[model samples]
Target: MVPGPVSNDRLGASNGRSSPKPRILVPEKVSPDGLALLASDFDVDSRPGGLSPQELIDLIPSYHGLIVRSETKVTAAVLAAGTSLRVVARAGVGVDNIDVEAATAQGIIVVNSPAGNIVAAAEHTVALLLATARNIGRADRTFKDGKWERGKLVGVEVGRKTLGIIGLGKVGMKVARMAVGLGMKVLAVDPYASADVARQASVELVPGLADLLPVVDFLTIHTPLLASTLDLLGEAEFQRMKKTARVLNVARGGVYNEAALLKALDEGWIAGAGLDVFTKEPPEEGSVAAQLARHEKVVSTPHLGASTVEAQENVSLDVCSQVLLILRGGLPTAAVNAPLILPEEYRKLQPFVKLIEKMGGLYTQHYVGARGGMVGGRKFELVYQGELAGINNTRPLFAALVKGLVSSISDSGGRDVNIVNAALIAREKGIVINEVHTRENSGSTYASLVTLRSYDTDPAAAGKEERGAEQIIEGYVSGKTVYISKLDRFTASFTPEGTLLILHNYDEPGKIGGVGMVLGRRGVNIEWMQVASLEKGDQGDKGLELSKVDSAVAGMEAHGSNTKGRGNEALMILGVGGVVGKEVLQDLTGEEGILDVSLIRL
Candidate 1:
């Protein structure tokens, strides 16, 4: 498989001064890491402050990618002018500022870094929840003003309290877990979350907001600002809460109506409110949002939910990674508007989409084409394990995998691949699809795992399953990152992102140096490398899987069937940054003790 047009057109064209690379427009301040990544492969125009709608419309036509934060508004008019745009990405989770409907109609992908900032947002929610219960913010302000009215400022206890939550997403689940640890009994209302998911978090699921409101001592919200959720909490909802109850919001603005919240405070419907977001940021002096923030009973902060350094870095990398993947003819899982899937299911499967597609891309590039086209396999094997295997419809996952396969093999940028047609394309090409579902075990190392291997038959007979490559790659998602847990028999911590160079060599001195010398001469920088050799099998890298010397001895005694278990074999998986031509790989293979090399891009 060859690098698709995204690399050859956007990336390879970028290698010289004659042809311009894909251009990305950044309208607001984003992480420097993201900026650097975009700048390396594309022409970047960064303004940080923002662009007016007219300025954006005027400038969007020539750009291929656009990266924004919450401030930049991607209007329909602006999108209409973005004739060349391939993607519009938000550096954080929300895409409210981006005209998603317009982007979808134009066949442009809309993506956001949803996984990156959940922890930061969840922690901030807890901070506000506690600050409101204990009157910590008002206490700090009054104490700073030289008043110490401890009796009047006395607060309530949260332990053993009944906590109510709206929206059981990643952030909500985390908040629920934290509340449970603090001895709170949690009840939640979310249409998307399964009862099993909530039960695992030790939360009791309720039917709706109505069912949840009346019994809460503290109510917290963590939902998006959509039509249904807009003004989700109003006077009527507030009236149902306990007179001493408190509420907090750190998710998005306007989910709790501003005027209604003020009335709740004024009427003493609820004890206090904690807010980290406003319908309008920096609300005018006399506006409802401003009044809510200034009220003596309200504990407010500027929208700082995703403000930590770690969150900034994570979001930057996550968004940039998707943009790069899409530009390079790959399907990105973090898309807000993908074709032919229900909105809710897309949301649930986004991260796993990235994981499965990457597995397919990796398998096709290194195993399929490298081993020769259409081997003995009757179909590609996909195995699902853990809680996610219960998904009723997995066609989207299959389509995503096939799209990755074509993206790795074709040069058309995979622009035609969509959830509806990827499976159809595979059938037309004589490639069969197979799947197996299994449950997660507590004794297993990973909570969820997706395995990709080749399933084969004699072709003449066609009834029985046989091993094709027998090389399996199992992918795992932890927190916000996707990694390869097991690549064949070796346990691994290999994050299959960007460009990777996998080298198989003999366990001998200078083998590593030989490959390094070739790459160095070619100006290809090795950003990271994972090594596995028989001599130091006890430990190699911090998280990478390594082959052992003892295993090699056992393998040799067992007649040397396993190549990795041979007494003098080693592996080097390198994360390379910068362009490497076929010449570099040819030169690498010519080096002594180097048996093979595979360069996989996703």
Candidate 2:
């Protein structure tokens, strides 16, 4: 029975903040009992059914948690619109309906109830296996029409049959166990499963599909629809299987190549198939799936692998509890994309964590243009030096850097991107991270320092220097305080905070006054300013892996030969009181010798 909603306060955060309850949006129908659990402590809006794509996008902007079923398509657009969304929960095992890559990119945790519907789906697969092998659907149709066709409705015996299971996961394992109990010999092809585990289940492990396909009397695919599993069983595979072998697919759509399966059915490559899913749901009119469903030798169900009432109830409750945990700043039992970090480790890494993100933001806003960014597919290479290099894990710091990079470019909440999912999000955006650690410090004022270098995907032409990689932001964390000491070719000293206006220009007269004039007219105050290149030389630049000479040469080539050296150019780091608008920025840029102007908030 479904439980009723209860009143409660907000969840207690790991950071010790008693923030208001997280709002959960169930765009698709889930069990009321599961919703009741969410309602007890958090706010839940269980919509009657799935909404249109646009409807979900429009409604997701303010939601922190989104619970969905198979019906809801959590596309990239919908995830982007969810500015405050922290987690997305699927009430079933497969999250193919959710844009997991997009969700991860925005640092949103994606969780699913892997165990809830396992038994039901496993049972359904067996049912379809029996039904198709015996032509039960055709017999039922003929019998319902008041026709007797006893001689034509011949069936095969399940006992002593050879069954090949493609995946040995929860549902697949359950199906294998059931098949073994029926006196069937089972062969599995899962690299993750060991020989001991398969032996425990009374199943034999095959080296590959080639070894299993030719021998089995029945082939059942239970793998998820991933890049590797997409079109896993096709024409070639079908031809290799036994002529009388039947097929079963209760896993996901597109797992078996639809066109190949249809051709196999028509050409008698295999006896028949039992399909519960299609590449396109509802099997559109005149579509391949539609034709496959109507085949005489095939048994079809409307993707009812988990349609039982018990399955629905179990999934809903399981998914809700997972959502509840994430909303309360806790990790779920089955998170698809979330960083696993101990609380002690997180605390130990906290100081550097905050510093790294600021460095990412600073690098983007301050040095990207100056370095003539030649990014290699939005790549960032981090070189951790000195004491910090000895730490076991550096994922949290890297994730923080990604969070900073993303937030610097958009109005999206920085909090939306965190250590939990930032790395996954970065990958979806084609962002690459290469990290190097050096326990020995070559020579530096600070005992520990981190350098974040950014570059795009495409490599530069022959003999051309990748300027983006040459440009880096160097920073350090002292206790809990973070400070940026270097930017590109400039020796900058500032605490990353508020909004900063970076001005690049030749070391000509009136450059500072020109910026002051624009700000003065616009009523934006210049609280403080630090001018680099005016100093004689940088002792800190010595012994660093990245030399400053290359940048000097690049800058000279970019400018004219008339500029002598460091004194010829200057980078002014200005602490601004207010945001400089487009007009004001243009005004500043129009000033003589003002090479570039960028405003970034940190």
Taken over the whole model, the C-alpha lDDT of each candidate is: 0.74, 0.74
Provide the lowest-lDDT 10-residue window in model 1: 1-10
C-alpha lDDT of candidate 1 relative to the true structure: 0.74
Encode model 2's per-residue lDDT on 522-561: one tens digit a residue: 8887776656653355322211111222223233232233
Clash counts for the predictions, in order = 0, 9
Q: Which stretches of candidate 1 lie over 4 Å from their true place?
A: 1-20, 36-40, 45-62, 75-83, 209-211, 341-602
User: Clash number for model 1?
Assistant: 0
- Please estimate how well model 2 matches the true structure, expressed as its whole-model Cα lDDT: 0.74
Residue 508, candidate 1: C-alpha displacement in angstroms: 88
RMSD of 2: 16.6
lDDT of 1 by residue, 474-512 (tens): 888887788876665555678889888887776554555
Candidate 2 — worst ten consecutive residues by lDDT sum? 1-10
